[model samples]
Target chain A: MTAAIELNAVEKRFGNVGIIRDLNLSVAQGERHAIIGPNGAGKSTTFNLISGHIRPSSGEVRLNGDVISGLGPFEINRRGLSRSFQVTNVFSRMSVWENVRCAVLWATGHRYAFWKNVDSLPEVRERTSQILDDIHLTHRRDVPAGLLTYAEQRELEIGITIAGGANVVLLDEPTAGMSHAETDRAVALIRRLTEGKTLVIVEHDMSVVFGLADRISVLVYGHIIASGTPEEIRRDPKVKEAYLGEEAH
Target chain B: MNATTTSASNISGKSAGDSLRFYGVWLVGIATLILLPMIFSSGGSLTSFSLIGIAIVFALSYNILLGQTGLLSFGHAVHYGLGGFAACHVMNAVVSHGWPVPLPFIPLFGGLGGLAFAMIIGWVMTKRAGTVFSMISLGIAELVASSSLILRSVFGGESGISTDRTALPKMFGWTFGPQIQVYYLIAFWLVISAIAMYALTRTPLGRISNAVRDNPERVQFIGYDPHVVRYIAFCFAGFFAGVAGGLAAINFEIANAAYLGAIQSGLVLFSTFIGGVAFFFGPILGAILVTYLQLGLTSVTGVWQLYFGIIFIGIVMLSPGGIAGLIMMHRPLARAGTLQTVIPSYVVAAVPTLALACGVILTIESIARTHSGQSSPINLFGVAFTPASPMTWASAAILIVVGFFVARLSWRRVADAWDRAATIARDRGYLA
Candidate 1:
């Protein structure tokens, strides 16, 4: 079976400084993968490279064996890849319903319908409400997404990411700022929502990485030191010294 | 059970009432448009009203860029002027060849002209939005406006290209020769374009434009090229602006270099923003108010441009939402039936503020007259007073100082009343 995502010898440089260097990573289909790294390890930059937010300096980022390095972010997204930002990036001016509806509109092939009222599209509205329901934000659907609390906005952001029904999802620290209890709930939602799909999450939380990921990659200073199942990663000396450390306990 | 039924009925009742209010406003607007010429049935006022109608379309088109898409364009008049010039040429062609096209259809050709230019320039302009796009637009406007002077064959040199509306074939026996006929033609387009632009706000492209405006990156994740959305919106805005220019061409029987200038672009921006960029009708209100001020104030004073500047500044500082926002702000109060409680306070506040305005106007006008070497006595609100008199100067200073203090006190009262009323509405759950 083709891998869901593959980044081969990827190098990213911002001006004169190297950020992500010679990164090689792959995730098989129907697996939950996590990338845990120290700060400034270019975790978000790695996500950006794969998601087409920025071009890699050198190397191939592929989805399902199809090269996607030079494609625009939207074009990449259209080819069954969707991503959530590290920051809560929901449309602040739009109501939560409209936010999800926008994603659903594009996913459902209503990219440029100007004559028809979007609300009248039963499929769009139903799917939007379904995603909103899955996020447990049905009550707050009418409020502007910006007015939502931070945790709620993150939930809405996740809903928007998966609303497109993309087979591969990249979530950049989906629960970065959540409380402990909120983090548990978000992990559960992510697990349930990303069932049977490929999820590559860049998380700083060791507990989340161990508890949710089927496999994990340890990245340090723009290079992956180790990649294995969570048990193997726990035992790998390089991963333990470079990243997991005492926190693996 | 009773509560559930009542709440359900309330929801349906609210939507029903909302739609009723929506249609009612449009009905009233149409009635006002038809009855306005009748009420002010004069040659000059008709001309002014027709210009207001044209400006309404122009401002609405500008709002598509500034308000809807959050793209501040400094060269929107490029399309408007091009459309007008195109319409002039079309009119000239129709007359010279007797193409059998009626005067009413001339604006379509203008719209096509605008669309052509927009298609050519939008690819490059829509690549960058915000400040960069705005600067590029400004540069383009200057380039085209300068070119208009040099391209005398196309722009008719400095005098502009003129064509007779009467030269075109009659529309069902009406040659559109009279200003009233032209007024009707403009009003017809004003209604059509306003409705079309409003409908656009309800479409997917419109919603996505707002999305792209608020968060372009998120829009990308949703699988949309923000550039494509911005390009389509720019094209539509140009098309409508061109249509307005076509109307202007018909109204004035000329399309000139002035039509493409920064001043024309600035006027549309001022009117769109002053009316309120947030609301759809804001630009319409702004266009009419600014046009009226332009025509009415210029007749009375030479400082009309200064007044426009003052009004633009005042609206920006006080109510950035413009007139539409100001009107919408009172909506909860109107619905709560407590609007009357603030009215007396509003009047009290207005009294001293009007005095302060009068004092300032008097000072400025006198200063201007003196500068121009007019030694004549000025009429201060029907009271003739010599500008050279010490009493006049002293009284003016007193009015300024005292008016300032009194207006401040009254303004406080107005704010207090507003807060009190707003608190009541919030307590009653009438405000969200």
Candidate 2:
């Protein structure tokens, strides 16, 4: 099977400061990998690079053995790589169901259906309803997404990113503002979503990361400090040292 | 369970039902177009209704970009003028050189002219949006408007170019000889243009235009470039604007620099702004209202311009949502089941606003109107105060104050109603 995503010696520079430098990582088919770092450690930049939102100064972003380093984000997404934003990104004016429904319609090539009704499309609605069910947003499906609480909005944002039926999904800071119960709900949803997909996440919350991620990668100051299983990540003295050091500061 | 949305469902039907309702709207529009000549040929008042139709389509084109996609272009006349000029050139060539080109085929050239203009201008304007984009568009409009006067060789100086459509190909061998026949021709084009534009809103590209308008970054993150989406919407809007221009050329049988002037741009802006940019129908409402004001105000007084400026300012302030937006304001109220409660005050507010508007109109007319031909003095009722009369002035002041207070009081109620609805929504399980 083709590697879902491969980043080789990826380096990103903003003026003179490197955001992501000399990073090499690969998410194999069905691997759920988590990138954990403090604020401004290039955890998000790594995902941005992988998602093609930012171009690498020198590196290769390969998807299924095809170089996609400098391709536009949508082009990368169209090639089966999709990602959620750090903050929630959804059609605020549209209801929760309409938001998901639009994603489904676009994906199913019902985008240009001027004469046909979108809600009448059984296949698209079915997929949308299923996704809503999985995300536990089915109850609020008819509610305007703008009216959604902080936690619910965050959930809907990830839900839209994953709604495109992509095999590889990148979720950034999914549980950022979530409460304990909300975090548990999000973690369970993420676990369910990542079951058959190549999932990579940039998360600040360690417990949620440890709960959902099969493998963990520690990123410090734009470099991958350690890459291993969850237990190995917890046991790494360097990882502990970085977290403790940041805490102390 | 939302009141207005549910009522709107009755008009537009539910999700799938909307398709049928849309089809029905098109059918009625086309039927009206088909019957327009029959109804208009016997007429005085009816003959001018088609002009309103053409302006509606034109205004709608402006709104497609300005209101829907949030890109304001002052140079929209490029497409409009190009459409008219292309049609004129086509007709002139067919007449002068005896080319076998049909009259119906001329608008294709107009459409092509619109597309070409869009391709050129869109490439530049779509690169930047908002203030920079608006400035560039204004510069372009000014440049084009000025060029029409300078490039008199092709633009035909001030006299313009006119062609008699007498020998033009007949629709089923029935010559379009009468002015009313021309009105029907314009109406047919308007209906087609409106339907096509309305259907366009349902297209993916059109929906994406809204997405880009709301947040370009999110659109880019989704995988498509915002510039590309904007370019496509601009090109389509330009195309429609050109179509409206072609219809105008057919209606008047003349194409001139005035059609391409900065005033032309301003009039379209006035129409679109007043109509409300929120709905597809907003521009149409604005256009009709503006056109009526133009015809009515110009006849009533010499100071029509001052009134237009004031109205434009009022629209910008009080009608920020536009006329269509004002109409749609019923949605939340109806949804909250409070529309009935608030209905009385709306009529009350409208009374003072209307009285104030009439008071202003009358004051201008009293000064500007020459009854049998008066010398240097003007009088209103029994008192004399020149064109700036004190009695007239006092009435104007009274009107303004009353109108202002009435509008303020009614507006406050509308705000209160919105807050109440929002509070209720939050209390219910609907909010979060």
Candidate 3:
């Protein structure tokens, strides 16, 4: 069977600088994959490549069997792919409910429904609330996303990412600034919400990665040096020497 | 699924109430429109109200692009002018060629004309957002406005094309010849377009456009193309602007080169922005206030545009949301029952502010009189004073100095009171 997400020799360059070079990654269906690396390892660039936010300089990115390299971000999203930005990118002006409802509205095929009141849509509103509950942001439903605390905003971002019910979810540093307790809750929420869906997460926390990821990929300098099961990656001498050794964690 | 449906029913019931409130507002608005002419039946006031109606439509249309889609268009007047010209041609056709069209329906043709212009240019214009889009629109506005002068056949050269609005088939035995009839017609279209635009804001497309405004990349990730959303919004904005233009055509019975001028475009932008783009009724308030000021100030002062500049600057600096925002800022205080606490502070601030404003106005007027070599006695708000008098200069200087200090002190008191009220409001959960 075709991999859920496949990046074959994907090369991304900005000006004369190569951000992601000759990278190959395959995430199996329903797999929990983590891309862990130091700052500027092109992990987020890889997410952009797969999500079609930016076109790769060369090679192909495929969701299932179809190439999604040249598609626009929305088109890719429409094809069962969704992503969250590293920075909490929720709609600040809109209420949290409105933000989640927007995603659910589009996903439920309410693209240009001008005649009907969107808030009255049964399916869209229900799914939106459910996601709000899933993210534990139900209490702050009426509050504008911008006014939410950073942690709550990050949670809302995840809620929006999954609200559309896309089978493939890309989360960039979901627990980047979370306290130890918040990170644990976030990992649990991610695992719970992304159940039965393919998750490709870019994270810095090794403990969270080891706890959540079924498979781990170590990327450095625009290249993936290792991709293996958590045990395989932990035992690999190359990963320890190249990255894990540099950081005590 | 069962639980979801139950909650859905609950929401539907709630929304049913919302719809009632929505229609109730429209009813009250239309009722006020019907009663307004009865209360202010003077021909000049009717004409002013009609102008306000047209401006309400125009400013709302501008809001769709600037406020909703965050596309600051500088050339929106192209569509408005084109639509007006088209409506004029239609009216002329009705009269000169006996085309047999009703005058009330001319705005639809105007809308079509506007939509056509938008369709032709929207794809290119909507490609870029923010500054570049604004610049391109400005360039297009300049291009079309200048061309209106060259293409005298359509734009009627400098004087513009004119037609008799009464030439059209009578509606319900009423020829739209009377100012009141035209006023009612504009009021009718204003209600319809306003409702339509407001309904659009509740639509999925409208929500996405708002999302596109706040965070475009986020909009894309959520499976909506920002460009497409912006383009659709631009087209809708153009269509409504055209409707306003059509009303103008029928109201004035003419479409001139000035209709498509940069000044016209700038006027719409100013009125819409001054109204506050964030709120739906902001533009309506803006159009009314701006039109009133335009008519009221021009009659009183030669430097009315200067006053407009000052008001616009004040709105930008003090209340960025404009008049609507200023009104909204009071909501928390009102809700927390602390409005009375702030009223005295406002009075305190207003006194000095009024004094400073008067002093400045006097200084400016005197300086202008002296510069123009016209030392004739100037009417200072009903009192005549010779600009050459030493006492007038001395009083003006004293007022400025005293007003400055007093205004600063009073404004500080107002700010302190506002902060206290806001704190209470926040504690009461009346503020966001």
- Candidates' TM-scores? 0.95, 0.88, 0.96
The Cα error of candidate 2 at residue B269, in Å, is 2.5
RMSD of each: 3.9, 4.2, 3.8
Candidate 3 has a DockQ of 0.53
Indicate the worst ten consecutive residues by lDDT in candidate 3 chain A. A112-121
Q: Which DockQ-derived CAPRI band holds candidate 2?
A: acceptable
Q: A72-128, model 1: which lDDT tens digit per residue?
A: 999999999999999988878777777888888888888877898765777887898
Provide the lDDT at B347 for model 3. Answer: 90
> Which one wins by TM-score: 1 or 2?
1
Q: Which residues of candidate 1, in runs, are more than 4 Å off?
A: A246-249, B1-14, B375-381
In terms of docking quality, how is candidate 1 classified? acceptable
Candidate 3 lDDT: 0.88
lDDT of 1 at A100: 84
Tens digits of per-residue lDDT for model 3, B114-137: 989999999998997989999999
Alpha-carbon runs more than 4 Å astray in model 2:
A109-122, A139-143, A244-249, B1-47, B96-105, B150-153, B332-337, B355-386, B401-432
What candidate 1 keeps of the native contacts, as a fraction, is 0.59
* Model 2 lDDT per residue over A70-160, tens place: 8988788778888999877876655677667656655777643455644456787788889888888887776767778999899888888
lDDT of 1 by residue, B58-116 (tens): 99999999988889999999999999999999999999998989999998888888889
Predictions in order: lDDT: 0.88, 0.75, 0.88
